[model samples]
Target: MSSIYIHIPFCKQACHYCDFHFSTSMGKKDAMIQALIRELELRKDEFRDEVVDCIYFGGGTPSVLETEEITLLIQTVYTHYQVTTDPEITLEANPDDLSEAKIEALHASPINRLSIGVQSFFEEDLKLMNRAHNATEALQCIMLSRKRFQNISIDLIYGIPEMSTARWIQNIEQALALDVPHISAYALTVEPKTALEKFIKKGIIPPVEDEVAQAHHAILVERLEAEGYHNYEFSNFGKPGAFSQNNTAYWEGKSYIGIGPGAHSYDGKRRAWNVSNNPRYIKAISQDMLPQDVEELTLTDQYNEYVMTRLRTQKGVSLSEVQTLFGDKMHRYLLQQAQSHIEAHFLFQEADRLYVTKKGKFLSDGIAADLFMLNLFQHPFDQNSNQS
Candidate 1:
């Protein structure tokens, strides 16, 4: 199934760890919304033959928009494209934005899922990350959201410097107490040029240790699984029937259209991304021109991506599908690359699938890299956008 991702490039304040494109000023908010709608209209034909199963509002902070503005965007999609009878529409919101009134209004809208950015339920963690919401706001918002929405996901960050193991467990317990159906937890990595990196460099904040992150991940897996939450993807856990359709589609390599500035889109064979600059994106859309760069994936590129994404999921990589899609030569090459990992008990082959063991989950990305068939036809644009 196809999906649509709309990036709202405005936030109340910048999170220290964030490197994603966004602006703190809302001076051009209305203009950005219109530009997003116009981009959707311009790209509707790309999904003319495909039914849209998901419409995700990702940020900066999508919750910053009023319910009416959000409805208008969704209505635009319905007017221009084929949407399913019941699509999984998600809004990535911050706790401070999800006031009681806001939650009620959002519940009335077409948004069926709420992915709240409740990074931590501790005051210190919030302060360290410069999150817009405090611990109380985080707890209160989720409690309020549960009254209106059943399908909800909360983001939590682990591996914060000076976070003790007991404190991390308390964070998990706090989430479990909220009863949200999905949780997407990630380790805090200091991206270059971000305030997080700067703080660590200045010795103002302690360095984030990988060993600590790994330990936290182990606790996360053990605690969530004991509570019956499926670790569907490496960083995402969901109750049965509560998996994120939007993210699952992405992991399965389904085609999707990404609207707004800094958004990325992919068809089966080609990927495209709009300009990250808000002014430039608006100017181009206003002029009825698509301000985007496109990349045509080579066979090796496709295989590498497939391996990277599939290996992170519970479904693992299908060895037979690998051979079927690539060839006997590439398939044999993959087996050869994976042999060492399998020998180390980090990976195992059961029937036609190769799965990462619990011991190897934390190292999945590196393992996938080792198995990558380096592309000789590397596109220059790919150097910047190849992470996914």
Candidate 2:
């Protein structure tokens, strides 16, 4: 099934660790919303034959928008394209923006799922991340949201500088106590040019250690699994029937359309992304133009992506599918490359599928990279011969 991702590129404020494309200004909010609708209309033909099963509102913080604005966007999608009867429409939000009135308004809208960005439940962590919500607000928003929404997901951050194991455990416990159906937890990464990186470089904040993150992740898996939450993905934990349909579609390589600036779309063989600059996007869409770049994926590129995305999930990689899709040579290469990791107990094979061991979950990216083909050679069975 296909999905639609609508990017709301405005936020109340910037978080110290975020490098996502967004602005703190609301001057262009109305224009941006119009532009998004226009873009969706312009791209309706792309999904004319597909049924949209999920419509995800992701962004700097989708909750910042008025409830009517969100409903208008959803209606626009319905007006322009075919949608499933019971589509999973999700809105990514922040705790500070989800007041009692706001939650009630959102519940009345088409949004059936809430992915709240409650990065931490501690005062010190909140201040460090510059999260808009205080600890109390974070706790209270989830309580309020649970009253109206059943499909709720909360974000939690680990590996904060000076955050002890006890504190990290406390954060997870707080989330478990909230009893949300899904939890997307991530390590605090220091992206280049972000405030977090600058602070660490200047000794204002201590450096984030990989060791700390690894330890926290182990604890997270053990604790969550014991509580009946499946670590379906490396950074995602969900109770049964609570996994994100939008995200699951993405991971499974289903086609999707991305509306708005700094958004991306994939159609199995090609990928496209809108310009990150909001003004440029609005100007282009006003003229009935798509301000995006497109690229066709080569055979090697597709194989690498398959390994990367599938390996990150519990399903792992299917050896038979690899041979069928990428041919016997590539399949053999994968098995050869995976031999060392398999022997080291970082990965294991059961039947025809290969999965990362618990010891290698934190380093899954690196392990997937090791299996990537570098386009250094061309096989006779390769279909995209132009790249060769």
Candidate 3:
């Protein structure tokens, strides 16, 4: 099955820690929406014959779109793709944008899921993050949203230096108390060039200490588990049957089409990403061209992609599927390299499936890089090629 991702690159305000490609300007919203519909038609044949399982409206913030704009995009997808009867159409929204009227529009739309960007429930944390919404609205919208959308997933950012273990526990407790179907929690990382990094450099904000982040991460695991949330993916926790279908499809290497600036698309063997600049994207697509960079995956590239994504999830890497897709020699390499992690109690093997254990989850990125193919350095994803 295939999936679709639409990037709405407009927001009311920019969060300090966010490095995503989005603009604070709404002047281009009308043009962007119209261009998006045209681009969807342009890339209609990308997915070919696979049935579309999920359509994700991600952002700057999708909730910023008017109801008519949202409806028109949904119509565009249905017109061009082989969408399933009950596709999981999810919209990424901020608490401040979810008004009563917008909620009513969402309730009546084809969109069936809501993924709210409730980074924190505390006013202090929200202010530190420079979030547009205050703590009151964050809590208020969830209560209001539940009446309309059944499949709701909210994001929580943990390990902010200002967020204590007790405060983190309260955040988890509040989410559980709300009883949303799914939750995705992440440890904050300071990416280069973000305001958070500059603030730390200037001593305006304290840098995130690795040890402190690790401690908070431990608390997250313990508390979410206690609250009956399964750590499905490394950063995601959900009750049974509530895992995000869109992201799960990505982790499983399903082909998907991404429409909009900074969006990426993968069709098993090749991947492409649009130009990140809004004006450049609009100009290019206005000329009937999809402004994207493309790469065809080499065998080694494919293997590394699998290692990076699969190891982060609870399912681990499936040896049977590996052999089926990559042939015997690749399978042999995996079995050989896996013995070390298994002996170290980081990864466990069961009936040909290799999965990361609880202790191994934190160091997953390092482990996956270590297992990369030694040969075939020409591939864009070759870890060693990019590393010193």
Candidate 4:
């Protein structure tokens, strides 16, 4: 039930909208890799001797690392952690870094799943995003990866202002055409302090249109459904049994260990994150200290976390389970708060489970906020739910 995530903080180029803690320079790659391995060994017992079921390599571009470095990291993890016999080991890669040799090396490693960053399969889209790979590489890498890894997932972005509706459909079709089993699609957002934001502020790049993003989301759902993919999470689709176990563990409140700079870990009751700077993290680990911060979750914080996460998945929230976990008093309060959303058709209650309708899925975050047990200690009962 425990998972592990290792962040590889190096990228070939910076995406205009990326605010993730990654460096375009490869200067510190070697030191960072060694530091990650050291950190893994130092914190081997963080998971309470539970069998590790999932290990995910996420970040700047795990694909950019030399295959031997990755192999060493994997070997170090296995040497310390009690990994399961059939662990779901995933590596996040990018097309530009994927070569036949690289894929072969990955196949030889412990990695069983590949999550490639293929933001778009169109050349213009790639340029606008400032991605390192071109359209051809994006399309070809998936095909090549299928020969090496069967449990494959790719990342795709939608809602770019210049991207046409037809093009978005083409992206979905292309993904289907590649026979990819899983996909993580997301709507483009201009985060503050990112190049995309600066471009918009400087009037260099057009602002993202909400209407366009919503339309693309609708198209994505319809097309993927027709293609027989389950819309498991709001932005994730999988072909039966192919959901990312590592990510699912996160949503289900399972404990996990995270290594490397800017990585996060949650131990059911508390959450922690390492320092985001590579140099800082390396220096701390060298001194045998984990450069991280931790926070213990309060009861209200736990309830709100459950509501936010469960509402994002297709299964929704289970009233009985909520009652069992948070007690009957909290359960009744949740039902009272969810009443208006259920009445408004934004949320539906069936057989003790609550789910967001397709019409309301786009507004899920807003709805979740509205349904939050914010004033849990205040009301304790008889709360009025508003249909926002």
Q: Count the backbone clashes (under 3 Å) in each candidate.
A: 0, 0, 0, 0
lDDT tens digits, residues 159-234, model 1? 9999999999999999999899999999999999999999999999999999999999999999999999999999
Candidate that would win on lDDT: 1
Per-residue lDDT of candidate 3, residues 82-166 (tens digit): 9999899999999999987788899999888999999899999999889999999999999999998889999999889678888
- Candidate 4 lDDT by residue in tens digits, 229-301: 9998898999998999987888777889999999998887888999999889999998999999999877677
Measured against the true structure, the TM-scores of the candidates, in listed sequence, are 0.97, 0.98, 0.95, 0.96
Candidate 3: regions farther than 4 A off: 377-388
Candidate 1 stretches greater than 4 Å from native: 376-388
Please identify which of the two predictions, 2 or 4, would achieve the higher lDDT against the true structure. 2
Alpha-carbon local distance difference test for all models? 0.94, 0.94, 0.88, 0.88
- Sort the predicted structures by lDDT, highest score first: 1, 2, 4, 3
Q: Name the weakest run of 10 consecutive residues (lDDT summed) in model 2.
A: 379-388
Ranked candidates, highest TM-score first: 2, 1, 4, 3
Off by over 4 Å in 2: 376-381, 384-388
| Steric clash count of candidate 3 | 0
lDDT for model 4 comes to: 0.88
Distance from true location, Cα of 23 in model 3, Å? 0.5
| Total backbone clashes of candidate 1, pairs 3 or more residues apart or in separate chains | 0
